[model samples]
Target: MRELRILRPIAKLEDAAVLDPVVREVHRVVDAVLKPRALEDLLHGVPAGHPMHPALVLVPAGSWIGAAVLDVVPGASRASRTLIGVGVLAAAPAIAAGWADWARSRRQQQRVGVVHAAANESAWVLYTASWLARRAGHDGFGKVLALAGFGLVGFGGYLGGHLGYRQAVGANHADAVVQRFPTGWHELGVLDDLPEEAPVRIEVAGEPLFVLRRGSRVDVLADVSTHLGEPLSDGRIDDPGHRGATITSSLGSVFEVATGEVVHGPATAPAVRFETRINGELIEVRLPRS
Candidate 1:
């Protein structure tokens, strides 16, 4: 991303705060009318086991690249125009998917997403013009516009990579927890070390984890939400029930204590559940390798 590092400041730009209200208003509208959690889940790719935006982006990106290549080849003007039109058509859904993912990202990630989106939309405008130019027989001008759009798309893609790999937007937050801790059982200290029945946050193998002790059993889960790294220790735990105590994040995700599964909305991925063993007065914990 060195080639695009010049735009790194965009993530810290204070003006991106202007869209905060807009994002909230959109959230309200979606809650009021599209309260169908399934649709949101689909857009976020919960069932698909990953975010959907990345897959959708390939459409416009690939099509535009193909169009650009065609523009340079001899006797491929007509095909170039066709591919450009295809890219324009596919961009709408890809943008929608991106917006869906953005709504679930953190503030910094949202800011980066804004810049990525703006660059992409600007490239789409150029692509549209290129399509029109070719249709009107301005071959040379159309090729120029296509090349410019291609460059802009590359910039946007870099930002998109930053949002995903660097910022962890729409990623399974629990996936990182495994890497921080070892695969085998490790001592969490004696059973008396726990905070009675309350949720106690502690460090295990360099990663934060929360332990909830109830009766003779103990449930250990990652202290951070698997959704956006929201601290699970900051969340409140309800009274234990049939399914287990419901741990709800301040950012609007819920997890079950017994299995660390997300039984509510927002968090598409489940919390990282760790195996716990109590021997006499001592307790041990381990994140499963499988």
Candidate 2:
């Protein structure tokens, strides 16, 4: 299908270098404030196993959209004001989660995200003002502001859709690894040739795999990160001697080397792991039977 003409300009926003300074500053600030590893992981949706921002966004967007509908209804002023206030308040945490996710995204995604965030923030501000205006008995003015804010919400939502779908932000880049390989066991390399407790990158059927040899057991995972396709083999390993060594992506997502489970976010999906068995000196790996 031909691309929509309207999207041409929006897509060009990815190359706008003007947004970089602001993006850098926001990244620094977010990194500083979300200093606690645990809290950062939570905001990144590590525990939820997917990005929380998308779900959290529904609350404020739904509330404000509902208020917009109620504004035209006679005798619904009180209820509309209540919904506006709820939307304004709920926007805070959603914004926090969004910024956290954006901070770790690729440059192209960040450029588009900056504008997306600006639009949403503007909407939030307008909604906040609308709530205050309504409380002060300026119902007509408040209704006008709410309507305007909802327009920005729609625009921002469109940009967010572009980011999440078009740009492939927050997608599981390694999700197709297992599918790319044939079902039977494939030889990776000799077990003794793999350096101990170090990440090794191997290619089988043209797909990169992250292999780690610790003591007698070997752990294998898709080399591409589930978050943004960063190379897992290039990342550092934590607790390499432990039962399950942890691998932190170049972009800060963490995963357990043993189980392929995400240990921290920016990565929501688990890495693709392979079941391994030694065929004498040759190491063979295959997708675990589910």
Task: Please name the candidate that would achieve the greatest TM-score relative to the true structure.
Answer: 2
What is the per-residue lDDT of model 1 for residues 112-137, given as tens digits with 9 covering 90 to 100? 77778879999999999999998999
Q: Rate the local accuracy (lDDT) of all candidates.
A: 0.81, 0.91
lDDT, candidate 1, equals 0.81
Off by over 4 Å in 2: none
lDDT for 222 (candidate 2): 88
Q: By TM-score, how accurate is candidate 1?
A: 0.79
Misplaced by over 4 Å in model 1 are 1-35, 132-145, 189-198, 263-268
